[model samples]
Target chain A: MKVKVGMMSFAHLHADSYAHCLLNNPRAEFVGIADHDLRRAQQKAEQHGVQAFDSYESLLASDVQAVIICSENVKHAPLAQMAAAAGKHILCEKPLMTRLEDGQAMLTAARGAGVQLFTAFPCRFSPAFQQLRAMVQAGEIGELLAMRGTNRGVNPGGWFNDPELAGGGAMMDHTVHVADLMRLLTGQEIVEVYAETNNLMYHGNFDDVAMLTLTFEQGIFATLDSSWSRPRTFPTWGDVTLTVYGTRGVIEMDMFAQYLRHYDDRAGRIRQVFWGDNIDALMIDEFLRAVAGEPATTLATGEDGYKAAAVAIAGYESIRRGEPVKV
Target chain B: MPYFSGNGLSDTCPRRAGNLSSVVNLLTEDAMVKVGIVGLGTMGRQHAEAYRQMPDVQLSVVYDRHMDRAEAFAQEFGATVAHDLSEFLKGCEIVDICTPTYRHTEYALAAIQAGKAVVCEKPLARTLQECEQIVEAVHRHNALLMPAHVLRFFPEYRTAHQLVKAGALGTVAAVRMRRGGDFPRTKSDWYADFEKSGGIIMDLIIHDLDWVRWTLGEVERVYAKSLTFRHLEHLDYTLVTLRLRSGTIAHIEGTWCDPGGFRVSFEICGDAGMLEYDSQQMVALRVARRAEAGQAGGVEVPESPAVENPYYRELRHFIDCYRAGQSPEITVEDGMEAVRLTLAAIESARTGKVVKF
Candidate 1:
């Protein structure tokens, strides 16, 4: 039987991508979608050929075995709680929640209800990162000393720039990906975090550029540059890259480099012709498998999401205190 | 594509910002301006070559503490050698101080006292005190002073600046600039000595510091960290975070640890779009339009116009400004500000705290 999967909200831009993954994945049935904005949800559902529900309760009342929470950062906890209480498996987005306490509540609710909860961190599904992780695990670079990562992209505005909805700015938007990746790859918890954030590029109300230095348990350290610094002319949005330095060797991975440059003079621009594997599809496959009895190794638990969010939440605290903070 | 002659310039000429009618008239009236150069180092040689290529200026004299280098440079550039500082100032209406940072004030003061326009290579001077001395000399002697913040003359950087000014990219939100090179091998290896060259933060990254300040505005505060190869050798690296008063943040990274050639890159983001240039990519700058209001727009990586030698362009602007009886594109105070900000970064790295301007 195909796993029944539905989307909660289309507030996050990733909602459509995840929906497409569910539609395409033969192992999962595209159930339905529900959003606070029913008209917007219907529009998205029409494009994906799925049912649209006007209310969260109505969608949960239906036969959705699993629900993907793709709402604003602040709304994640509430939405996840509703889905968990309805006894549905959950796949929440990057930031589990803006607040650590809220993230904890979502985890408690899902655990109490005896449901599987996953975080949508699809970067782990990229073949390049998978290879890098494998090599690191195999001790190709010996024990890790330091790693440097960058997740610079074009600023995706909307709730992302709004502190009320998104919770923070570039630091909040970008920190979780690299933070989670570092923790997952090294199998170590981040012990401390120090961050420097500012809105220098657009001089907007929120910060768009930041540098976060994280120290992991076992004395591993990493620096993450999370800025929306890519220009419009870049072939792609930007890159999620990591350069890992270990005792024996070094590993450099550009997760999005598997693309051919497509320059169209008629359009007066260049575009990336991606030839890489569909990471979203791979991630959705893992989620469905985990929904069954067996689980994937790279499967990100709600605990993984909470740990990453803890680092990011503590990062904001460090920025406020003007010093390093423990995670 | 349009190559205008030295004296004949159109209103759209990239050389001047505004009406060059006054400059044209002044150029027609004045003789080819005689320029003297102090210091026969790499920068001095570059200035001499650039001036030699210009029809509107004459490289009249060259000087260095080591007279052999000066003589060698003068012979190649068709200029005379000056054995001393004052002798170098005697034959020219303008002085290009390409000396070590510590000697900038001495040559600048001599040129100012002699009532000549002065163009000093960047950082203005090594210390805030020396920078102020040069500024005071400019004020006291009523001289025209231009600091060579040459990045402003580069086509890609200039285009980015013009786009921002024209509101094409909207408001700047963040910037990331990187500049790196192998350890400078000078005759005295002056760059290795922190007291003289102010190391990589002052000597190398100041170019980016000035460019960002020029494009954005004043830096409100700074936090920085660095790694020095003093224990291993002479390499140096620094990463500085600058928060602008306009609520923009910038990260400037500088390193003298490159095994070979030098490179510079900048990425500027705005609300509407972004401007990026990476020398390592060896591609034209990339600009992207915001996907807005249901419009699906991707990036536009257009080929950039041919880049002129910015060293030549910077010198040309200085000469043109001097002829037009106008101040330089980069003022003495602008140079002073860059030095102050860079010094503050050094302090931040030392004190392990943010330095507010």
Candidate 2:
């Protein structure tokens, strides 16, 4: 059964790119698109060769089984609720919900509608992450131990700058994927978090840099760094790698950068380097397979997204109190 | 002829003991490989000098922001000066980025794009994403990037890594590394600012993160406590605790506030052995254990002057990688991991809390 997919909007910068993936996907049929902004929608539609509709209702009612909501961060939960109520499976862009209750509300709606709700936290599909997970599960590495990971990037202002629209800046948008990956790979619920988030990078906007230290249920201590404040020229899409120290062996996977190669011809020479994560295509492919009901790969379930939301919100909560939050 | 065939092991034939010249003789092959320096700042110059007059390699050229510096470096090393970025790159097959943190990406990217192999200083990039972009560029262009986690190439760290990898310490039970030093004061006004340099933890302690991760694997969580006081006043000093996916615990105490002096050391305690490493102290393996007959557990030490300068080894590895079209020892991905850990440390520091890995 082919999963017919429709674009909910083109409000986010990466909306068109996500639509392009669907457009090229075999298992998922690219239906049509809907956005409140007609001109922008039409422009995106024309660019992607998909039909554009002035109203979301028209687009939602089209013969599509699911909708990938590439809408604003704030609208995610509300729109997800609506799409779910309409019996449509939802694939929404992340930070799940800026607020914990909103994430729960959407989760409730999806559960009540008896449909699947998939949140995008693509790092879980990175090749390095896959290898890490394999090592952890297979016990090739040994007893679970303390580890550290980082995912920092330069600011992505635009709508992300507006607190109301994007919920939080880098703290909200960036931490979700990493938080989700932690729970998925380690199988440990974060029990406590001491974190600090600030806007140390882009000239005193909302805080876009975040540092989080975590104590998991198993007493596995770890740290997750997610900032939109990375200095511009540091190579490889902001790094995300986990260093897993086990009883038997230690494994380090630069989920995004182990396969980095570049040509340095300073001395008439070409150089090759491996970077991190060879899983963007694989992740997208996995998403399609999950949508197609292919044994349901462990994705960012509403639960997973919800956990990230809870922890992230709690991180903010702790930040406000200048204290640590025990989960 | 390069004698690059080191599987890093004991072959039942014990060579001469505790001698630098003998060590060099034992290690080198017949040919003196040509090497070049890119981004001729302090590191570029140091690496150039490190490689100059070496039995293993010859200094080919030096490239820098200032053509005069490049020329001066060339004069000093009897090498060539890259008149421009393109020309300099064309003359040297080996490129090193000692550029400021911000310029790291551009210089590295340009070098890689020009078909040269590279060795970059830490943090890969300010962001994991930038590292990923560079990594992608490397893949698309077929280039090699060896992010210099020079500590890994150093004799002490190399030995420690071997013991850990060989299970010298049964299974790694815990790790703690401490590094404290006064900030350079003025790499730039940007270094004074936390944004560009990523503060002391990202800029300095990150050395530990790279080495620890290199020794361990992935971290499951991080609980960090940090402050910005004393040395550099505004620069941060941090203590980060890491839990790996394998349940091994680790901690790092880092500071840009070392008013006393520079301190660099790490201790790895496994089930079997407890090992320690400090550059200022001992450059060889120092393991301590419970001694019999009321003699407290004392360090079983290896003799010193293990003077294998890892920075030079790192650059040589980069050169070998570039010349051979092989994978580098410390890759961009490794840099990315270090970047990610740096960000996570910042996150933990910000919230004054523990963070999920």
**Against the true structure, whose lDDT is highest?**
1
lDDT of 1 by residue, A1-327 (tens): 999988999999888888888988889999888999999889988999989898999999999899999999999999999999999999999899889889989999999999999999999888999899999999987766667788988779898999999989888888888888999899899998878777756567887777776777876656688887776566788789987765555676889888998888988999998899999889999999988767667868999999988887887898898776889
TM-scores for all candidates: the values are: 0.77, 0.52
Error of 1 at B162 (Å): 2.6
**A102, model 2: CA deviation in Å?**
0.4
lDDT: worst 10-residue window of model 1 chain B: B1-10
How much does each candidate deviate at the interface, measured as C-alpha RMSD after superposition? 4.3, 18.8
Model 1: per-residue Cα lDDT over B1-357, one tens digit each: 112222223222244333434554555425779999988787887788677656567788888899778778889988999877778789889999888998898888889999999999987999999899989988888889998988777777777777777788787777778777556776687887888888889988898898888889888888766654232245566777787888777778776654434567887777677777877677555456674796422211122444336777778878878877877768999989999998998887676567887
Off by over 4 Å in 2: A258-280, B1-357
Per-residue lDDT over A1-327 for candidate 2, one digit per residue giving the tens place of the 0 to 100 score: 667888787887667667767766677677788887888888888888878888888877777788888888999987898889888888788878888789889989999998788877777777667767887899876666556666666566688888888887777777777778778878889988766654434535576656677768966667676666443333434566566544455565666555545655664543335544334345555677766767558567778888887777777876786567786
lDDT of each candidate versus the true structure:
0.81, 0.69
Worst 10 residues of 1 chain A by lDDT: A243-252
